[model samples]
Target: MIHSTININNNNGNNDNNNNNNNNEIEEINTLDSLSNALKSHITFQILKDTFNEYSKLIKYGNFVSLKHITTGKYLTTDDKKYLTGSRGQIVFSTDALPEANAIWKINYPFGSQPKANNEIVSYGDTISLQNKLGKMLWAYPNYKSPTSGHVEVSCYSMNQYNNWMIEPNISNISTKKNSNEEKRYLKSEDKIVIWCIELVEH
Candidate 1:
């Protein structure tokens, strides 16, 4: 899971205030208009590569993967609720203390891009999209700034480049080593991974 910053002065000001005052409690709001997450972020299952080969390397196209935040152990989730902001995008956030219904994400290539005819295996550095049960895909808006980090805003939108992500292994925070020599290795569920490009990552 990732961080969706909640400004103390936003519409959920009262909840944010309570989160600050209450040490052991916080609201779980996950909409753009009132982004307050006490749970998790949009993440992919990641296990440290030091023990990568111990797991099955078979994450293929059309697989339903619940990306678990390697650090927080949270699951990436979203809903059909639209953002009240100008983009009116679907809300993307992290939740589920464990992988649950809201955390399930479908894996696939870009909607109109060249399809993989023979290989269904997802390779390292492949550009892919993660779709939720509501049919919205994970999106990162480079044009919009996040309310918290002043970086690109990550949400669930459509099947465009913004939604396409390049995945790699052994990246920082996720792993300390990078196997650049390994031209293309099959990616498996729970394999510590990094999704970059406009910063849609959970490393």
Candidate 2:
């Protein structure tokens, strides 16, 4: 069974909340109301996942996981904050701040192409969806740049080159690091992970 069902009260699928303008400019940037596996591009970096460098645990569908930005040591987060310009999108930023709610995300199978079993763990080459507490799925604006960072804008948006994420394991702060089988690497809770999204250009 699916671990949990997220109830997004999006005006019964209407953008009526747009009028609320409660400083939640982030949610309005998403026009992808449908959460199906709409990404048509193949994994642009299929050659990279073969690097068995770090032993990471397998993430399963419907798993609530936290993704921390490696360099900044901050959690990938989003909220009611808005960007002053660019895509007019809601802001998606990394923060080393308190209040853990916004930093937590639930991993989901793409809407229509769900797995036969909900407990199926993530493996190499698996494409997944990430949804936040506010019920907004993780999204990115590939064609746009952030007004501040001037990089690809990633927010609780929708389908793009999720390209497929490579899980990089973090083993610090855990009192004990245990691997039952020498041949297997199991990712555990609070494990630090890196998500890489590379854009491919077809020539």
Candidate 3:
């Protein structure tokens, strides 16, 4: 089972606002925390093992990995396991638990550019896109059901930034290899770079 640690601060600042406004903000934060906890409780080790086994074969690119939310320590996942028929309204959410089938994402390089292993400068126009097992690409909207939702969704259309994603590996995983045949090859051809073994960590 996946576990998440959340820190909630209830400190009151010396502001001119009335007590009612502070109480309201506190209430909203508590509600959001409750929802996050509920999502975490649903994840179990069996579900994660099963999901990994089922999707292991579909992962082709070395960059393909599970995305962990920076703040929540949760994975991105679909609202349900049901198949979506290329609908733009398909819902995606952050889950405070191990990912299921819908959460697996394949990182794809920009069109016309060859894939590289090094952490080269990838512009927004050349940013990678995330594709799920269902063949839908991840999309984000400026305005959706709510402003706080971040407007993340999956779409069939291959739009610009809506489809583009920036994925950076955990800093601890980035290291240089010395005195190896692969390093010699990389020195000969800078274009041919190899990414060492990496353990995906929360952003």
Which candidate tops TM-score? 1
In the range 1-20, model 3's lDDT, one tens digit per residue, is 33344444445764456654
lDDT of 2 by residue, 1-203 (tens): 22322233333445545775333322222334322222212243333343332223345566666666656666677878777666665678877762455766766676556356666655433556767666777777788888778888766554433523344444444223346753334344445544522111110
Per-residue lDDT value at 38 in model 1: 26
Per-model TM-score versus the true fold: 0.56, 0.51, 0.40
Poorly placed runs, candidate 2 (over 4 Å) = 1-57, 158-203
Alpha-carbon deviation at 10 in model 1, angstroms: 77
Candidate ranking under lDDT, highest first, comes to 1, 2, 3
lDDT (Cα, 0-100) at 134 in candidate 3: 61
Off by over 4 Å in 1: 1-57, 98-101, 117-119, 158-161, 171-183, 195-203
Q: Clashes per prediction?
A: 8, 5, 0
Considering every candidate listed, which one attains the maximal lDDT?
A: 1
- What are the lDDT scores of the predictions, listed in order? 0.59, 0.53, 0.45
Clashing residue pairs in candidate 1 are 1-41, 1-69, 2-41, 41-94, 44-67, 45-67, 45-68, 47-192
